[model samples]
Target: MPLPSKRYVKVNVSQQFNYHTEAFNHLVKMLYPKRNTINKYDYLIDKHAFFTESQKQVISKTASSLCMLSEFYRDQDKFGNLYVTREDICNAIHILQRELDLQNRSLLLPPVLKWYAMQIQYHFGSDPFTLKQLRLQLGKSKSRVYDAVRELEHQKIVKLVGQRGHAHVFELVEHI
Candidate 1:
C-alpha cells in the first residue's frame, strides 16, 4: 500500500460520479474476502470522496478479528442495535477491562500487543503462536514482530515451543 496521503483534499460533486466504479469494485474484491455487501462501504467512499477500500477493509478486518463475525451479521439482520441490553455492554466492558488489567500486569507491550495476543490465543487453540501463522495474522512486517517477541520474552510473557522454517512456534509463559 502506498504511504497514505497526509491530508484530505476537496472533492467536487461531479468527481464522485466520475470515480472508477469497476476499479473500486475490484479493490473491494481484493480487500475483503468475506465482506459480500458493498452498500455500507460504498456510502463511506462516495460521501467523503476520500479513503480507499483497502484502508476501510483493514480497519473493518482488525475490528472483526476482535469480535465474532456472526455478531456483526446478527446485528445487521436484527436491524440496527435498538435491542442491545445494558447487561451486554456491561459484560463486554468487564471482559475488556479484565484483559487490559492482565496486559498491564505483564510488562509494557507493543501498540497492538493485547489485540494480537487475543488473536493468538483464539487461533492457537491447543497450540499458540507459530511464527509463520502469527506473521500471517499480523498482516505486516516480521522483523518488527520478532523485536516485539524478544521484548515479550524479556518480560517473561512468552516463550518458544519450536520452529517452523525461520519462524519459531511460541507459547505464553504465564499459565493458570
Candidate 2:
C-alpha cells in the first residue's frame, strides 16, 4: 500500500522578486562592469556602450529569462534561489528571440509612450505614479502626457488606479 500524495509549497512574492532582482543585478554588474563613479547614467542599460554584440545578447537573454523564471515562480507559488543552468541559458536565448520580435512591434509605438513606459519601470519600479509627475519629469503638457499614458494603457503596459483633478494615478503592468 502507498499513501496518497502529500506536498506543501510556500512562497513569498516580495522575497522571491528581491532575490531574483539582486541576482540579476549582480550578474549585470559582473558582465557590464559599471563605471566606478557617482553619476545619473551609471545604472542605465546602454547596449551601444557594450564592446561586442555577444555581451549585449547575453545580457538581454539573461534578463528576459530571469523575468520569465520569476513569473513562473510567482505562478507556481514556489520560492527558491536563482541557479543559472545551461538549460536556463538556452531557454533564455529563445525567450530573448521572441521578445525581440515583440520589441519590433513595440518600436512602432510613439517614442513618447515608450519613454513613459521606461521611466515608469526605471524610476517607479512597482510604485504607483501620477500623470502630473510624469508631465513634470518629461516637461510636457497634460494632454500630451495623457495621450502617451492612454496609449500605454491600450497596449496593456500600464494601468490606471485612480484620478484626482488633473492627476491620474497609474502603475506599470508586470510581465511587459
Candidate 3:
C-alpha cells in the first residue's frame, strides 16, 4: 500500500474498540472488586474534614450512621406501628420480593417479625392499638409495642399517620 500522508494512521476503530472493552473490564475488575466504585463516589458529600478517598468514605458512613442512630433512639415513635402479624410479615416480605422481583417461597416468620406482624394485625381497623388491647391481646408491654412500631416503620411496611399527641393511627401500606 502506498502512503497518502506520513502522519496518517490506519485505525480500525471496531477492532480497537473490542480490545478496549476487554481491557477496560479487566482493569475495572481489578480496580474495584465490588464494581460499586462509581456510585460510591457519585453520592459522596464534602461535609467532612478529609482529603483521601478512603477517609472521605469513612467520614460519610460515620455521619450517616450517626444520623440514623439519632432518628432511631428518639423518645417518640419516629415513623409508626410497622408490625402486623405472621400473615402481615409475609405480606411485607412478599411485597418487597415483588418489588425486587425475587422468587417467592413459603416460610415461617421470625419471633420479632411475628410480634410486629401481630401489632399491625391487632390494630387493623384501629388508629392505634390501645395499651390495654395490646397488653391483653399480645401479652406484651406498651414499651414493647412502641419499639416494635418503630422497627416496623423503619422497614416501610407500615406508616404512622397521626400527628404528635393525637390518637395513634397506623396505616398498612402493603395490605388493603
Question: Cα deviation of 136 in candidate 2 (Å)?
Answer: 1.1
> What's the candidate order when arranged by decreasing lDDT?
2, 1, 3
Q: What residue runs in model 1 are displaced by over 4 Å at the alpha carbon?
A: 1-104, 107-111
What are the per-residue Cα lDDT tens digits for candidate 3 across 1-176? 98777787676754554455345445544643432211132232343222346433333333322223333332333343121223322333333332222121112234685556656665564345533455567777878877776655655555777644554656655432
Query: lDDT per model, in order?
Result: 0.48, 0.56, 0.44
Question: Could you give candidate 1's per-residue lDDT for residues 1-176 as a string of tens digits?
Answer: 78977687787643542343334445544654554321233333234333345434433333333233234533433333222233333333233332223334342344566555556566664466666676787775787677766766655567778877776788876532
Count: clashes, candidate 2: 0
The estimated TM-scores of all candidates read 0.34, 0.37, 0.33
1 against 3, candidate with superior lDDT = 1
Steric clashes per prediction: 0, 0, 9
Off by over 4 Å in 2: 1-108, 164-166
Candidate 1 positional error at 69, Å: 51
Ranked by lDDT, the better of candidates 1 and 2 is 2
Candidate 2 lDDT tens digits, 1-176:
99887586575754554456457756755654531211122123342343245534544446544544453442222243233443444444443432233433344355766777887787778788898787788788998888888888866678888877776789887522
